[model samples]
Target: MLNIKNLYASVQGNQILKGVSLAVNAGEVHAIMGPNGSGKSTLSRVVTGHPQYTVDGGVLEYDIGGQMTNIIGKEPDERAREGIFLAFQYPVEIPGVPASEFLRASYNAVGRHHGLEEMDPIDFDVFVREKMKVLEMDDKYLDRALNVDFSGGEKKRNEILQMAVLNPRLALLDETDSGLDIDSMKIVAHGVNTLRSKRNAMIVITHYQRLLNFIKPDFVHILYQGKIIKSGGPDLALKVEDKGYDWLIK
Candidate 1:
């Protein structure tokens, strides 16, 4: 559902992603693992059309109906409307906006894009609650300002909750396991696994294999020096876990 070809991107004039390429099809989960500053997070941000990163070369394409269309110039919102979702490493706090209010606004915006009718607050509350159930979240979260004073684990779970609500066709989870404990990671993984379907795909980026133990990606890739240097089955992550990147880097 998504294809990135030899993508070269830079931030603040310093190149980060150099000649990176990968293809992800529907129903497949791919895990990207690499050392720090190896362009793992850069790939996610570039794919999501982050304004700070400029794509200097190569094609960014997505299946926008049934055809692979180049999306390099598309705005971030345009990409989001096209079923591209990014779960941030650090979810920012919005002090005044209730989580429910924020979620409903996003849901309605995406719904409107697809010619669907917007749900009223009462109706949306019912819909969002069901999604919250998938994450085992309580109703109190709905009233709190988005991520305001939420614990690290709560913030991570909230990111997964947003993914459930948006139901994006291509989900890019950037270090979702960051700052999460084992139990919390399992809960977040459960919510992610529940959302897996034949109509959607996911690219999970992380620095460790423990997250893969819960999420269980079908494919594992080793990204190094701004490029994907190795690709294999789930065992690849195990190899990385057993032996550090230096073995592969050598």
Candidate 2:
């Protein structure tokens, strides 16, 4: 449902992504594994239209309503409205914004953009409660400040909770496994897998195979120096876990 062709992106003055390209089909999960500085995060951020990232060349075409449109010229919020979601590795804590309040506003905004009816406070609360149940997240979390004073795992779970609620066409999970303990990792992964379907796609950018074990991807891509250097099935994850990316260093 999404395709990026010869995409080049840079930050400040340094170019990170160099002619990267990939295609993601609905109902398929893709894993992008790479060493640091290979532009993995850069790719995700650029695809999401982060203001800090500048597209130097190439086209980022997104399929919406069966029509392909170039998205390199769109803003981050515009990209989100077009059905792209990016779950941050480190969720920023808005000190005073309550989680429930933020979520309701976000959900309502997306609904309004799609010309759908916006949920009132009560309806939105009920909707969020249902999603929280699916994610197995505690209702008490809704009373707390958004990510403020939350544990690393709690922050990550909260992100997944947002994903389950919004149901984006494509979700870009950037290092969702970082800083998570075994139990937390599995919980988060389960949440992601449960939300996957014939109409949604996921691009999981990770550094470890443990996350892949839980949410097995249809394609595993090894990104080196801003390009996809290798692709295979699940066995590549096993090999990387065994080999430690040493051979891919060159």
lDDT for every model? 0.93, 0.90
Which residue pairs in candidate 1 collide?
A: none
For every candidate, C-alpha RMSD to the true structure in Å = 0.8, 1.1
How far off is residue 149 in model 1, in Å? 0.8
Q: Scored by Cα lDDT, where does model 2 land?
A: 0.90
TM-score for candidate 2, please give it: 0.97
For model 1, give the RMSD to the true fold. 0.8
Write one digit per residue (lDDT tens) for candidate 1, span 28-142: 9999999999999899989989899999999889999899999987899889988999999999999999998899999999989999999999998998898888787877999
Off by over 4 Å in 2: none
Number of the predicted model whose TM-score against the real structure is largest: 1
